[model samples]
Target: MGLEKFGKCLSMAAWMSLLVVYAYAEGSSRKWRNEVLKQVNSKGPYIGLITVFPPEETAFFGTGAFKPSPIHSSLDLSGRRFRIGKVHDKKVIYVRCGVGMVNAAAATQQMVDLFEIVGIIHFGIAGNINASMSIGDITIPKQFAHTGIWDWVNQNGTLDSNDTVAHLDFETYNVPKGGHNILGQIRYIHEEFFSVSGEPNIARPLFWLEVNQEWLHVATKLERMELEQCINKSLCLPKKPKLVVGLRGTTANIFVDNAAYRDFLFHSFHVASTDMESAAVVMTSVSNGIPVIVIRGLSDKAGGQSGQNAIKTFGPLAARNAAKAVLQFLKQLN
Candidate 1:
């Protein structure tokens, strides 16, 4: 053989070996998929998913730089690929679906096009309602009320039929084949009180429905009971994520600005927390048939600080907790 041919063959062998080594390095499970597997394992199927905004002020889903694909062909509807993951567990993925409705919808479609996610949870922070919710209270919302969609319902108790709404009742929405698991509650953390006249915080949960099935059948009936119990009991405790899970509130537009507007939301919706991205995440996740959960942390009261400051204090912490919750949920599902 020619000297040049032998050299080329040697290079090819060296490259292949490097590729094999890279796949097994430390923290190798960071990406989805692994050594191929055929027969279904004893563990449950994979559950592909995505998260929007989360606890950071970052945005995604609208950047023209990285558009998502129509669905990774290797994975099944359960979000499992033939040879993915070191443990053959419920494979999952996350997306920074940006804030608001438009971005969230785009990300949801991308997730669905790429994998078979069984459930979704829109998790994030929210403002306070009625001065009743304190910091670190987990609220599972049953409805999402967007003030932009309609007039603000007053705490004074005057029902106005003319109220238009950018918001939708999450509990009323239909979920797909598996239906989202016990989506009636939203987790929340209350912003701290700095002054004698500090602004009231607004915190709420995300709302969404299913694209394939009308309800998630896997949620044990006891799930609802457990969540509600946690919320009722959390009020007396002093901890982040008070664990109360039932009938949370949601909004459409960003309302963390003025005291009047904030108070209006508080009295009107009777919500306990508020944030910017959950509703969009919920709406889109439902439309695309991907189940998602949102976990938000209270960063500031409407006029508290610059965007930079807000992220600095709570951004990393919230993201860490949200990631942990998702991993725990995935383990429970499997």
Candidate 2:
């Protein structure tokens, strides 16, 4: 054979060998992942049931109809607990994700990583920002955006005239120039999420991470399902609590108690509810390519009321209502 032919043969043989090794590695990785999922799903698919605080979880584990599950707690590595049990004869792994965005996101990531959860159902109490909605009403937002991410733009910056940027001016607070945590203006920014795709996806900064649409469609069954109007005999709400779905929701680390900020969220994003943890949970689940949905009962007006926050009085009741809705959702989830 000519020298060129010999070299070509050698190159072809090396390329073929490389392809075989690559194929075997890819197959093994895929098979291993499949085995992990299969092992977790051996008996049944365990649904991830997550709540924020004690009140939110109390509805499920502390209340009458919903007794404590025979929990098999795990995920000890993160110093968090994941309770495994059967609810309505369905497999569930319940965990309290704690109070803020960090806690919620971390717990959710841990839940997905530790166990092969089929999907996530995050329930909690949230402040109602929609004027039309009332306390005791439950909201199942189609998607949640982490509105907390921001860019504190100086007054001299270009955002003043930039209509594209959703900037919240701190001028209304009247905190004065030298006051603590004073700001000129803040620009809202989208949180960038990592992609499973091998191709570059840097331009995609995600603002709203949505729940599974098919799951949302199943939630339509919950609309007609009746909800409790009052927690007790004397503490009835002004109107019967309604189920409003496909609405917008927002989340932030800050516990919102100001009507102005509440109004800004409503006006800017048309959010029906706002909470501290829902967006983080949703973001983590969606980023992991896991299906997730949020159910939040309105405990208080997101500081829209003139008096003190209504959550103090109605928090438990709202959490209970949300828990009830979560149960109903689970029934329909199958």
Candidate 3:
């Protein structure tokens, strides 16, 4: 064959290869979408919402609440489904991916299927462990600890309930020796919430206090135990999982106010930060291969509100601050 004909044949082969690669990429994306959609759209109504809160009057009714009225409802938008209520934007199809691990995962699956949420910002309230972080400060956790994912993913690749809660973290920040202070990196909201006359009356006496206290205590103890075990066993093992020392708590549970308890976590877990739903969010993202960013406001201090009402006053401020940080984060991604 002439040299010119050979060059043309090679060019044709390269073009064919490019087409094949594009086809495979598109097919893989579609397959992933279908898998996620099948599980989420299996049952019930689908809608998008940005924020969620338990049905409570105190924080819900607090001043400067940007959320819609009635706290929960459904609304129609331009070619999108949205759950009306306290969300980022009624126009943007936001999914109320509920609270806690299981609910969060289920809601997220549904959100992805129905709304096809390209990116998500799990913004809400969180407790502050670092003394420097005042109320209304934002936390963008670089590392998520004590989440149990690493334990379950052994070399064998088998699902084991025997594995403990996986301690996961983000790739954004580095672990500092002698501990790192989480104050200056993220956006800080300096504001206060209004003080209500009485305590938030819970119909069911805060059962979470007891449950959280026990689990909270065990989680810290067990995390330390696991870390120590990993360190001690590291010499004998060829490959060991990475261990991080930081605080990992949720936004919803309010048991974190006890100083002694927070102090216990500080001493035991060596945690520098705290948030409610970040771990669950991280876990879901990790499971689904979705990128997740969690930024929250310091609604309540680690200790009880000295004379101020955080749940009443700071909730809205915290929410707004979190929203701002999320917006900034989204902007930077562009």
Candidate 4:
């Protein structure tokens, strides 16, 4: 064949291959949507209520408040149990997403894919990093950021000035043996999340991921909503618990119990609560275009106290408060 004809044939072959790729992508997207539609027609269009562990579950599910449908009883998938139930006369799909960022993110995405979740309401306990906040208090944060991600520099590596981002110094824990302060510094960093509208597998990096504003507006109705301040009749919080809204919440995989780290978080990020999972849940839901909100009860001060951690004694109380707040917030929704 002539050179011109050969070039034309090659071009046609490339176009055919490109068409195949696009067709596959479209088919895969449609399949996912069709699956969600089928589930909605049969079972759902329900609100997704999520918690982290058993301790958080007791306040919402251990009692009779959640009535699980016999047909959808304990539908287990991906190491999580999704209970289709009713809470305060609103249809809800309740699930415990286990612990940590990975579990939280996986369960959230799974819930969105398997159920037609209109919105997400996640309630749980978190460590207090804000000095003004107290245990058993409920915080409905306006935004969430995954502060767990870090850029660890070498002992001798240079970093940008304070004008950039706050860097954590390890010199406090070390006596300089020589140069480099004996330990490297850590710079808190942002996370990159993919959205549906963005290019495939590419999304902008964000230091703080804002939650849905309409949901935040609805959460304002929870102001002055009562919280549980007592574990029992004798043991109660020194001060009555109050509902605090519009705080900033941060998330990490590591359980926070260090005083210095807590102070850094409070001062740098202005974070009210630090937990293992909130940001993961928020990011996943937002990526899927579903509005999500978090209700966290401050259980401990992230090692701000002098003695044993307060979580053991105050966790139950905090969990109960978060559960109550979630209920009241839901009542205001519809």
Candidate 5:
């Protein structure tokens, strides 16, 4: 009886030891899967392409031969669809990031996590803030700034309002007198302030996000290439669109159709164009340490034009031109 009891105790000890080993192995496997397995499973190094709206998405898709992949995010609460394939012989993943900063950031983060993307490229239509820029003209901004963050200041430069400020101050690249006609060096102010508190109690440092120089070089080269000059016969532009590099881009949730605000943004931020999504993408990419570039085609003159809203008429044209530029850039990358 003593020997039998001893044997039973030994069997129980072995079973418990096996259970412990199995549990440890399972935990390690999960860890490895999370850290390394997805990377190995990824069909990359991919170039991520983002467009903001349906028209922009249509324009981008028209530029390349993309094959729909079975891969999709099971956790995509936004229900945004992702497509993967090739553009100019380089692997590409194309997705629509919706129409604003929140959507852009969410989609970008998902892309970075889901794929082994080497870089991100955002292309779409923007309201032209530069008076010299015409409809169909492409602007590849050197830096992106979130213009929504502002501290309401009095005429004396004191915080007039008691609003909470998220950013105490930030600096942006200043476009020169000659415009971003060349790949000029970026400049930033010493300090600028943004209010985070209604009581003017708190503020944080905000920095302008810079585009990857290597990608910027590619964009500069694209300026020399001829792009689609016409959208369609009905909406034919007076002149062929031209590409310009080194502009500053700004983003806000507001659709800046007001001429006064358009001029204000241009004068204050030295921005060539304003859009809704690029700034978010830039911030997201910066946080992830990924290289990114933004290519925008002028669809309208903000509120500078008095006759009618040009976006309704020229949006597709601008999107197509931007797409053409992006495709050319991808070709050069190959």
Candidate 6:
């Protein structure tokens, strides 16, 4: 009987110990989160600039032909390097957010949570959805949407009596109802395995974040400024690239190289450009109530004859144009 009582007491003590550990962990987590929040919100109203990778990063803020200045560096919680400096006399923090939606979203969230950023600007090369838009042309999207989220419906066994479907079959979730900008309204359908680890495979909302109107005005004005037409004498272009603003843009994980898909997205979303990161950045910005804009230079027409080859050949030129436009916009901000 004494042994039995001792065993019960030991179990209770163990349970209590576990409770203490759990409480400590919870408290530590909350404290850490609060500290991060404090740090991010305490910083000055700095602009956040994001590029997909190193080349684009080099184009925007690196020590290359368009030498800007010595950029200050810091590491975020994720160990991603952030370059802090003044662009056109305006305070800015630039980061290469890697490539694709996941990287973009994570980096954006870190920027929002760890810095007092007033707005976000994403400058990178993108595949042009608008046939009229040529390589090296800069595009400032009015809004951004996630083209990757889709709903797949099986209609193989749901045929009509006459073996012909009466209504449209296999409908896709292109644009979320009531528009994609409304938070919590847009639902995403995804395969179970495709869901991010630790995140449930539940319906997620698609966000169509709009660029700030004031920023858009500034961007529009920058169009009148002289832009670089050539990277060098040997790399001269056939025509001087122009800045096109107020067009729609979309983002997805896939690098679209199919003409049919490109045309479909262009017509369906009324978008002029497609990239792998812009929409995710926009969504994160909108969720945090910060204004954001995407400045994309066309490295290639989506599924053009040159295809992905154009990205390598004209990518640096396009990135330079984008950087020029961004600088012009920053100057206007000042």
The candidate that wins on lDDT is 4
True lDDT of residue 277, candidate 2: 93
Which ten residues in a row are the worst by lDDT in model 2?
67-76
Best by TM-score: 4
The stretch of ten residues in a row with the least summed lDDT in candidate 5 is 182-191
Compared with the true structure, model 4 gives a TM-score of 0.84
Instruction: Give Cα-based local distance difference scores for all models.
Output: 0.43, 0.81, 0.44, 0.85, 0.77, 0.74
lDDT tens digits by residue: candidate 3, 1-334: 9999999999999999999999999899778756644443343232233455542222323323335434234433222234433333322235444455555556665555455454455656666666655665555544454322223232223333332222222212335434443331211111111112223441221101111122222223222112111113332222221122233443322336665545544554454555545555554444444455555556666764476545555556565555554434433342
lDDT of 4: 0.85
Q: Candidate 4: which stretches are off by over 4 Å? A: 1-41, 160-164, 172-180
lDDT: which is higher, 3 or 5?
A: 5
Clashes of 5: 16
Q: Candidate 3: minimum summed lDDT over ten consecutive residues — where? A: 202-211
lDDT for model 3, on a 0 to 1 scale? 0.44
**Candidate 6 segments whose C-alpha is farther than 4 A from its true place:** 1-43, 62-72, 155-207, 306-308
CA shift at 90, candidate 4, in angstroms?
A: 1.3
Q: Model 4, 17: alpha-carbon shift in Å? A: 39
Q: Clash pairs of candidate 4?
A: none
TM-score of 5: 0.72
lDDT of 6 by residue, 207-226 (tens): 46577787888888877666
TM-score of each: 0.49, 0.81, 0.45, 0.84, 0.72, 0.72
RMSD of each: 17.5, 11.0, 22.1, 9.1, 12.0, 10.0
Question: Model 3, stretches more than 4 Å misplaced?
Answer: 1-49, 54-92, 146-254, 304-309
**Residue 224 in candidate 5, Cα distance off native in Å:** 1.8
Error of 4 at 333 (Å): 0.7
Candidate 2 local lDDT, 230-296, one digit each (tens): 7689888888888888998999998888888999989898889999999888878877788899999
Candidate 2 wrong stretches, greater than 4 Å? 1-44, 63-75, 160-165, 172-182, 197-203
Q: Per model, state how many residue pairs clash.
A: 71, 0, 24, 0, 16, 2
